[model samples]
Target chain A: MYFTSFEQFINMNGHGFYVWLSYACFALLVVTNIWVAQQRHRRLRKQIKSRLGRSAKV
Target chain B: MSWFDNWHLPKWFYQMASPKWFYDFGARLQPWFAGLALILISWGLVWGLLYAPADYQQGNSFRIIYVHVPAAILGQSLFLFMAVAGAIGLIWKIKVAFMVARSATLVGASFTALALITGAVWGKPTWGTYWVWDARLTSTLILLFLYTGVMALNQAIPDRSVAGRATAILAIIGSINIPIIKYSVDWWNTLHQPSTFTLTSKPSMPPEMYIPLLLMVIGCYCFCAWLIMQRTRNEILDQERQSSWVARYLED
Candidate 1:
């Protein structure tokens, strides 16, 4: 409903490239954020699990 | 216990200081927000990009609104959130607040970058150049540098606690510039056009176009919030790994 079609919408008359590229940049940033979070989560999870085991033994 | 009735502000924030609380909270809320983010972003983009009619003058180039405006708004708003979070952590010495500040700093940087890049692209055909040193554009560049400064401050200090205070101070002080960046387009006769979506002023465009724009902006904001929660939770876990609750978390 935002537009009629992807191509039609992107075509922004003749400004499709700019609009689409701007979106490309947007997508890039979002994906990067998600990736960084996931990576940190993995690292932290491992760290917490390891520390918990050592503390338990101690 | 329901997450609602039991929630008290002080205890709630204090509990959030625990990595276990953050992890559980993030895990619990992730699906809801993820779904919301997906739905809003999809519906909004579809409406803005497909349903909305192209502008008569700019033709299709005006479609950049779907991305440009939302990113610009989120970019500025995210920095404000960072400054607030940083200030709270600095004043209260709350570890969770600091983590949230750190997450927001990174997110703000990314959003600011997206805004400038998108704005430049949108400028080329309309303004007859890829970039112009318009007042708004120049101020936005400064905004991006401010984001970098916060990020750099976070990394520079070796001590985590000290770094938190330092970054928080910088973020809060730098926040003063946010309003300036926002008004630059308005106050100065800048090359950048004024905002399409305004509160008091009636929109010049048709409902079809404005509707999509509204959707995109809302969806993007939700997406940013969800991402911040996830990142902040990660930071909390990293910091509180020595705690018993973290041990309990690992057991799960």
Candidate 2:
């Protein structure tokens, strides 16, 4: 609301790069943490299921 | 049921310390924490980026505090949690405690890395240098190295229980660095600023600024809770893969 336009909001009186970069890096890291965990969980589940299926066939 | 069943605390503690019980409890808790994290993070980012007034002194460059402060606080607290969990595991030989301690390393390392990155980026604009070897900064760097070392030590050990015992010792010893990092600015002539929001004192910033910051800190904690739960659950699955419960749970 402080800014009159989108450009102004992004510019932030010439500090836009630092401000935006910090936020972007943070957002990326947080998302990556969750994503990596979810991926690991999925892989573990798949491994377990496949192992169980193989044992059942034997 | 024994007489202890009459007391909820011991019963809950015992149950909660079991891998199956903790896994089920974490499964239920993770989504709620994730939901709160998303809500609070969005609210804080929006408010901090758009509505909050720019600092009169630092201008919009100061806005980085929204991320920096929260990450720094979470990073430190996560390390503390790792140490305490490590201590419990060492003392009790509880599998759940060891799992929790092991689960904390990756998340704690990531957060510590984030804190350092954000601090360096914020320092560029405010302090005119991207990095400095100030006491707080140096100590923080050491903390990050300690986390990395613990992770490396765990991975190098083939036996799970032995690795847990070794890493737990390192974690406890490394915790000594935490207080030094916290009080670095107070103890030494450093470029880093003193603490802003302390438990014993009124916040230095106004409500408008501190409110968003508060929300962000809470959101970070929630995110940590969610992520740690996910890692802990994965640890349980890995450790208990041959157990009947995991097989049954996976079947569904």
The top-ranked prediction according to TM-score is 2
Candidate 1 lDDT (Cα, 0 to 1) = 0.76
> Per-residue lDDT of B111-164 in model 2, one digit per residue for the tens?
778878877887777777888655545566778888889999999999998998
Task: Encode model 1's per-residue lDDT on B48-138: one tens digit a residue.
Answer: 7666776766667777768877877887888888889887676556777888888888787887788788778877876778786655555
Provide DockQ values for all models, in the order shown: 0.65, 0.86
Estimate the TM-score for candidate 1: 0.84
lDDT of 2 by residue, A1-58 (tens): 7678999999999999999999998989998988999999999999999999999999
| Top of the candidates by DockQ | 2
Q: Which ranges of candidate 2 are over 4 A from the true structure?
A: B1-9, B181-203
In candidate 1 the C-alpha lDDT for residue B217 amounts to 84
Candidate 1 Cα deviation (angstroms), residue B103: 0.6
